[model samples]
Target chain A: MKVMRETIVSTARELFRSKGYAGASMNDLADAVGLKKSSLYVRFPNKEALVPAVLDLTLQETFGQRDSASGQWDDEFVEVIEFIATTLTDRGRCVGLHLAYGTSDETPIAKHAVRAFFQAHRDHLSSILSRAMPVDVARDIATDTLARLEGATAFVAIFGEKDAMKRAVRLSIEEAKNAAAAKSLSSR
Target chain B: MKVMRETIVSTARELFRSKGYAGASMNDLADAVGLKKSSLYVRFPNKEALVPAVLDLTLQETFGQRDSASGQWDDEFVEVIEFIATTLTDRGRCVGLHLAYGTSDETPIAKHAVRAFFQAHRDHLSSILSRAMPVDVARDIATDTLARLEGATAFVAIFGEKDAMKRAVRLSIEEAKNAAAAKSLSSR
Candidate 1:
C-alpha cells in the first residue's frame, strides 16, 4: 500500500540521516524496518534508488514539522523562530545536509533527486519569505536565513551548545522585525 | 620544509573547495601540483590529516584575500563583510566549514582542527562587532551573520544561480551593516 511505502521511506531516511550515505548499508536499512532487503527492492530498485526517496521523506518531514506547527499558530515571530530551531537543533539533520549538499549530481543517481529536493524547498521558502517582504528580496532573505540555519546547526551539532544556536535564532527574529520596523518607519 | 607543507596544503584546499571533499581525490590533488599522491602524503599522512591542514590553508587564504588597499582595513565593518563574503561566496571555504563543523572528535581519526580555525575568526568577529555595539548583542550578530553567510552560500551552491547568490551576498552585506547601524543607534 502507499502507506507502507511511506513508512519504508521514512525509516530509510532516519537511517541515512544518522549514518552517512557511504556508511549506511542496505542490510542495516532492512533490519530497521523488519523487512528483508529483498522486499525493499520491490519498492526501491536499489539503495541508490532508495536514497532520493529517503531524502524526499527527510525534506518532507522537515517541512511538515514546521508547516503543521506554523499553520495553526498565527504568530509570525514564533513561526519563523520555531522553523529555524527545528531545522538547526537536530544533530541528525545538520549532518545530513552536509552529506547531501556536498554531493555532486555527476551520476544520474545523485543529480535529479538533489535538484528536486532543494528546488522544492527553495520554492517553499520563497513563498514564506515573500509574505514578509518584496518578492525578490524576500526570496533572498529566505535563502540567506536558511543558509545561516544550515551552517549554524552543523556547528551546534558538533559543539552541542544550544545557547549559541538559540542566540542565532534570536538574531534572525530581531533582524526580520528590525528590518520590518525600519521599512514601516521609512514609509511613514 | 614548512614552506613545502604549506604549498601542498594550499593547493589541496583550493582543489577540495572547488571540487568537494569526495570529488577531489588523492590523485587529482597530486595532479594539481604535479606531484604524486604518495609524495603528497609525505607532508600529509592521508586525507584525514590533509583536510585539517588544508582547512588551515583555507582560513589563512581567506584572511589573506581581504583587501588591504585602504589603511582603514581594520574597520570592523570592512573586516566582517569581507570575511562573511569569503565564507559565503566561495564553495570551497563553505565546504571547509561544512567538513570542519560536521567532523566529530569521537575517534582519533577525527581532527579537532576546527577549534584553531574558527576560534580566531569568531573571536575576531566578536571583537570587531563589539567596537560600536553592545558586547552581548554584538556576539549574537556575529554568529548570526556568519551563520547566514554559510547558509546563503550553501543555497547558492545547491541552486548555482548568479542572481540568487549575488542577491544573497548583497543582502548579507546590507544586513550586517544594518545590524551595526542598529547597534550604534542603541548605544546612542
Candidate 2:
C-alpha cells in the first residue's frame, strides 16, 4: 500500500510540474500512475490532500541535499549554503514549486506549505548566520537572502534560461562566502 | 477615454498586488476606479491586455530606479549587477510586470516583455563580466548570481519573511565587487 501510495503522489507531482495546477486534473493523475481514478482515491483522498504531499516530497528532497556534498570546501556551513542554493534552483526545474505556490490567498494548501518552508528556511539560515555573524545581522541577512533567491528563481522560471539560472547560484554562494568572511573581520 | 483606459490598467496593478491575479476580476478592477465595464473597455481590450500594460509600467518604474542611482556606480555594466539585486528584494512590492509575468506563463503580453528583459540582462551582464574577469568566468558568475537571486525570491514568496533573501543579496553584491576588483588587479 505504501509503495502504491508513493507511486500515486510522485505521478501527481510530475503532472503538476509539467502542467500548472489548473491545467492538471485528478483523472490525469490517475492515468499517469496507471491506476483507476477510484484506486487513486484509495491512496489520495482528493487532489488537495495529494498535491501538497507531492510538493512536500520535492521540497524535502531539494533541501535535503545539504548532507551530500564532498569537495575542497568540505566545511559543514559551506555545504549548507550550497544545499540551499541548489534547493532553490531545483525547485524551479524539478518541481516548479518556485513557480506554482499559489494564485492567491485562497490557495490554502500552497499557503500552508510555503509558510512552513519559510519557517524551516529561517531556522536553518539563522543557525548558520549566528555562527558567522551577530544574531541580528544573521537574521536580517538570512531573511533578505532567502527572499532574493526566491525572487530570482521566479524571474528565471519566467524569463531566464539554464545558463542564467546557474550564474545566479554561483554568485549567491560567493556572496555567502564573502558575508562569512566579512563577519569574521568585523568581529575580530 | 485613453486616460480612463490607462487608469484601469494602473489601478488593476495595485489590486493585483493585494488581491493577487486570480483574486481580482474585470468587475473589481472597474469598480475600484469608478468606471463602468463598457467604459473600461475603451482603454483595455480585456483583462489580459490591461495586465500587460500595467506590468510594463511597473517594470519601467523598477528599471527607472536603477537609472537614477548615484553616478558613482552608474556604469552600465556594473548597474546590471545592482539591478539584479534590487529586483530581487522588492519585486512583490510592485504591482505590474512581476504580477502578470509571474502569475502564469500563458500570456503573450508577459512573453514579450520577459524575453526582452532577459535579453538585456544577458547583454549587460556579459559586457560587465568580459570587462572584469575571463569571459567564461564572468559569464558564469553573472548567470549564477541571477539564478541565486531568483531562487531566493521564490523562497521568500513561498515562505513570506525573507532573512535568507537579505543575506544572499548583501553577500552576492560584495562578492561581485571583489571579483571585479581582482580582475582589475590581474589586468594591471
* DockQ metric for all predictions: 0.36, 0.30
Local distance difference test, per candidate? 0.61, 0.58
What ranges in model 2 sit over 4 Å off? A1-3, A18-47, A59-104, A121-156, A164-188, B1-3, B15-28, B34-41, B64-70, B74-106, B118-169
Model 1: per-residue Cα lDDT over A56-149, one tens digit each: 7767665665653355222554475576476658643553464455455544675567667766666676666555656775555555555656
Q: Which residues of candidate 1, in runs, are more than 4 Å off?
A: A1-8, A22-42, A63-77, A80-84, A128-133, A171-188, B1-4, B18-25, B64-76, B83-93, B106-110, B162-188
lDDT of 1 by residue, B68-111 (tens): 33333236455556655755665434655655543455423433
TM-score of each: 0.76, 0.65
lDDT score, candidate 1: 0.61
How would you encode candidate 2's per-residue C-alpha lDDT over B75-155 as one tens digit per residue? 654455555556555654433324433455566675565555555554556555565567776665565555455555555
The candidate that achieves the highest DockQ relative to the unseen native structure: 1
Which 10 successive residues of model 1 chain A have the least lDDT summed?
Answer: A68-77
With candidate 2 superimposed using the best TM-score fit, by how many Å does residue B145's alpha carbon deviate from the native? 6.0
Score residue B103 of candidate 2 by CA lDDT: 52
Q: What's the count of clashing pairs in each model shown?
A: 5, 53
Sorted into a CAPRI-style docking class, model 1 comes out as acceptable
TM-score of chain A of each: 0.78, 0.73
For residue B58, give model 2's deviation from the true position in Å.
1.9
